[model samples]
Target chain A: MSSADFGALKHPFVLRALEPSDYRKGYLKLLEQLTKVGEISEEEFTARVEETRHLGDLHHAVVIEDVERLAIVASATLLVELKFIRKCGKAGHIEDVVVDSTVRGQHLGQRIVDHLTELAKQLGCYKVILDCTEANVPFYEKCGFGLKERQMARYFS
Target chain B: MSSADFGALKHPFVLRALEPSDYRKGYLKLLEQLTKVGEISEEEFTARVEETRHLGDLHHAVVIEDVERLAIVASATLLVELKFIRKCGKAGHIEDVVVDSTVRGQHLGQRIVDHLTELAKQLGCYKVILDCTEANVPFYEKCGFGLKERQMARYFS
Candidate 1:
């Protein structure tokens, strides 16, 4: 649905691909609403945006924008992976899913995840997957995601 | 190290970036040695290679080559992910880490992992991560990787 087509939205909002200008200021503002994020300089933000853009159609930065103030209210990323496996030989990873607390009950998160999942299928991903916190498990389940493996990670910092 | 730097070899082998020519015949041979994979037509193989190559430096396909047979015998992929996090602002994913069973225990797996880990650092990734089964955890730990998060997934078919 278009950002302006937010008839169900108490406020006007649209879901769309993140624009270049949105990264530095607008994105950080909406992102920090979900979690505490370290400050990123505008130059770094611009460079990183360009880098992700260069990742081609396999990567998508999707966000919901409030039309009135033109502010982002939610966001998620879809990363398609190439694999040497059966069928489609590709996989999709959904990450950084978040909705502004102010807009939580609107089911915006569900819509965003659903949108990305469809996009992954269109991209010929054999499967769509994600890792979420233990508390977020039920949320993903509600969005039609099934838990299969325990999420694991390693941080060098 | 250059592919030709096989001077330390007890057997004839080289490590190198996967060339487009390796996609169809050589890659499949090595991949099958790792696990059972479905057949991939030459057309599909070529198309996928071109698509992945278009992904630029964000993804790396590293392989071990059998000098005598002129074929890939072991392989790993390094994917760089842009993140809105601290430190380097990016993460690295190591996938498809496999060594040919015929050449098992030659330390080729360790060398390949080490190579990709270094590539991640150079790519400005704050951390390098992968998901492995319990049996393989010690192998990765031996290669200087430590367990951090419990792995999780939602596979669609």
Candidate 2:
């Protein structure tokens, strides 16, 4: 569905690319419900958003904003990586997906993921991939993603 | 280790970022050693390289080049995603890692992965992650990556 089609969401909720003004909209606060979100000032938030904007259409940090409440209720980022393989095919990586704790049962997470997955296809990606904890496998499956491989990480202090 | 430290490798082998001129150096041909690489003209290759170049250091497509042969023998990309969490922290995702089949025993894959892992740390990434097939588990483990979660994928035609 196109951005114009988001009217299907409840009156107050709309999904769109993250904006600089989201700092005041509790964007970071909503993310804290998913993982550690250290204090981020408005300046830093806007600067980072500008840096991502320089990446052109390659970075999509989609968010579901509650317009009536002036707050972000859910978010996820779809990162497109250009590749030399598959004849320069693009690969889509969905990262940091989260739904505000208060909006748990609303299915906002699935809506945002499906939207990004479709965006990936529209961008000519050969595949869209994501890594998730065991508990979240069923959720992603419901969104049309199938288990593919194992995710390995090395943390840096 | 810094780029200069790559001298530890056998003579003529060095790891570095993907250069525009790499198109003439068999970079795309090298990737075909790992996966399907459809016909890509030199013009297209250089154009894509230029586009990726615009991303600055956020996209690092490192390669192990055989200077003597003027060919890219191994290659991988380290994509850094800016995050609002952890006070604007960054996360790194490694993709399309491959070592030429002809030079498999020289440990080029390990060397390249190690270099990118170190690069990610130097760039202040909270974690470096990758999705790999089961057969490659032992390989990445030797490079200091441990299984963290499952990778899910949805392919688009």
Predictions in order: lDDT: 0.74, 0.87
Model 2: per-residue lDDT, tens digit, A37-114?
A: 987889999999888777766888889998999999999998889888888889999989999988888899999999
Error of 2 at B56 (Å): 1.2
With a 3 Å backbone cut-off (N, CA, C), the pairs that clash in candidate 2 are: none
User: Could you list the CA RMSD of all candidates, in the order they appear?
Assistant: 3.8, 2.2
Best by TM-score: 2
Candidate 2 local Cα displacement, residue B147, angstroms: 0.8
- Model 2 score (lDDT): 0.87
- Write model 1 residue lDDT over B42-145, tens digit each, in one string: 78777776776777667788788887887678899888778765621777888888888878888999889888887787777777878777778788888788
Please give each candidate's TM-score. 0.83, 0.94
DockQ of each: 0.40, 0.86
TM-score of chain A of each: 0.87, 0.94
Instruction: Give the number of the best model, judged by DockQ.
Output: 2
At residue A148, what lDDT does model 2 achieve?
Answer: 98
